[model samples]
Target: MRLGRVTLALLAAGLLAGFGSALAVCLCGYGDGLFTTNTSITIDGVMADWATVLLDTDNSSCDGAAPGIPPQPDRDDPVQSTGRDLLQFTYTWNGTHVQTLTGRAASSTNIQRFIYYADSDNDGLMETGERVIVAGWKGSNRRVDLYLGHYVASNPGGDPMLDINGYSDGYDLPGTIPDLSSTGTPDYSGDWGAVDGVSMEWEVPWADAVGAPGLGLAPGSAFTFHVSSTNSNPGAASFPDQVDDNMGGCGGGAATTQYAQLDFFPDRNLAAAAGTTVYAAHRVTNLGNGADLFDLTAGAPTGSHSPGVAFFRDVDRSGTWSGGDVALTNTGGGTAIDTGTMAAGDTLYILIQYSVAGGATGTATIIATARSGFDVNRTNIVTDTVTITPLPRSSAPARWPRPFRPRASTTRFASKTRVAASWMPARSRSPTGCRPRRRSLSVISADRDQARWPS
Candidate 1:
């Protein structure tokens, strides 16, 4: 049907306006050979310094971390850097990408800035690392770059990687070993971050982070380790790049390089001390969605030149196991033995005896395998290191101070009143040191004319 002149005019105007809006969204067309740059653009409304998954537009289910993601290899354990702190990045991606990030905790716990994220691309958050190596590596500017941590390495690549075993025993977060949630002193700073750029967050139950009491990991139970990154857009082009001295998946605008490096290390090992046990917890967590525990195929990192690279397993359920590259039985669950296939949020604990073995000093390395599920190119091949002390000793005992224990049924008392009835050891101590002191009877509680010790 032929429209009137007025109607036609209005229709033409509306069509033209709609086209203009689409053109704006598409930035019209990129002039050939014109590589427009972005500082940190807003992606899906969020500013990203690099090609970070801005929004989960496809709603891809990173809902749960992949189950059975083996515990990280010792050398590959997530690193918490020193002197060099925080992770930073700068990015520019050609297309819109969807990224899923979550901070799942064991007990409805919430971490504020607890998990760090940044803006790297001008597309308003064009990229974000899967795990923050360092939080809020500060920088405000035109290039898409976010700061995380400082860099450290004397290697040839200059592109340094984190050394999980190289970190110092950082500040201790005091709390008792929690049943599910840790309120007691937990080595809170022990974190494993992934810069493979697949910045998805994994919320694991407390049970997974720690092993059951007593059933601590045995010496030398190895497990798989990994660091990976993924872009929701199948078309992202990225490769390994460094930001904030952190190495991650850097998008190359139409060149996405899905890569993973996996290796093996003990779930838990002894701290660098002799005669004293520093519970080194190496837990293999399930990073997949399914609820079954899969067998961890053990591969000995055999090399002629690599000495002291011993592997062991407690095959008989006896408190002891042979120190070699294999174990007959894979202990899983319960106290004193937290090593096994875990359900979606479960973890297996493998303890290693990490001390100056054979009077050797320097570093130790162990390797494991990645059989299936995760992309081998993106989830296999990793490494970790255990350092030998600089102190010269013949298997000397290096121990932290022990906590004070109560004497057998000891009883003591204090009073404020003169001639007050009170009692304590004659060697009672005061700010001035153990001295003969006197107290007044008035300070004694009326309810307690006398009190009995817990007899």
Candidate 2:
């Protein structure tokens, strides 16, 4: 069961009363290529507040482009026409939510659909669970209809017409109904109504637009997104390119390439005896917008012990080494290893193993570092400490004296050797052939030994 869309129309109305006039007066049209805005926007089918937002202009003239199949006829004027010709598209974030506006060259009564595909995980492939927005306009209608839903197929390939499902209708937005009764026909039930003018505007919450938690878009986060205009024709119906051209299966068309963030976690401390080995587990994640490789390096240990350090990829994330775990070789000196390639939002478990030398003692400090393979400047580091102690030593003598003979005569023999007092027997002969009548033995001095005989 899918949840209904939370409408913010009342909230937006209140904000408009306070900030609408100021925004309209203060904001000048934005420069080309600018995509963000800080001003408040009202979704009243008017684009005055969006003046400061940049425009993503599509190929206006019909030049028989390869991707735009059937070649959009030269209906490049927004004031007149009957066909759906997308001229420009743009969107802006006002801190709380996003407002998207699209312009068309034709204003005559006709059916037009604007589709937005969001790659929330930024993995370059369209998988299930990512959101898509469809804004539809019929003839001469004042308001636009917005439908919110997620891709349903394992691999949607960026086609909303084929893969969108379980989507619910919002405030004036209508749910998409398939025209199963007839093939290759426009689903009129999916149309929201006609636009009052040449442009259409819609709003989406920030959380709902970006996607699931932890993978949401933030500052410096990069991801691929696709926007297209369609007239419901088969195969080559979309403008700016065919629906299947440069699709998610082909890595999508527009992706940002600046961010290459790597996250390393869980600094560790371990204890081990001399001549033993110990391991510390860790995890590294790629938080950027695209797939990237990371270089792993384990610094040489510092302190009393010079333990050998090795790195491994914990394939199962079991925290223990197993057959499936791969040993990372030293691509550079001093336990440096490579992480191959990791996709955006993907995490890899790692293990740092230390081999303690037989005579090693005290503490050894090992530093683990991860550097982005794409950008050397982007790196993360963590440390692991190993406390090594020597094995305990035995103080008891290696051998014990034989049983002594009892005698009536008293003879005492003293020596500098320190022996266990409990090992001495009463009225017995010493190991050196001296006999004692009683167990009263006293030390004369620290450096002196004496012998006494009594009959």
For model 1, the stretches where C-alpha displacement exceeds 4 angstroms are: 1-280, 292-341, 353-359, 370-382, 390-455
Q: Residues 206-268, candidate 1, lDDT per residue (tens digit)?
A: 121223211111211111111222111111121122211121211101111111122333432
lDDT of each: 0.26, 0.52
Best by TM-score: 2
Instruction: Pick the lDDT winner.
Output: 2
Cα deviation at 235, candidate 2, in Å, is 8.9
Q: Could you report the Cα RMSD, in angstroms, for every candidate shown?
A: 31.2, 13.8
Root-mean-square deviation of Cα positions for candidate 1 versus the true structure, in angstroms: 31.2
TM-scores across all candidates?
Answer: 0.21, 0.44
List, residue by residue over 147-244, the lDDT tens digit for candidate 2: 55554433335323222321111001112222112322322222222234455666666553333222245533444455545555322212223221
Model 1 steric clash total: 116
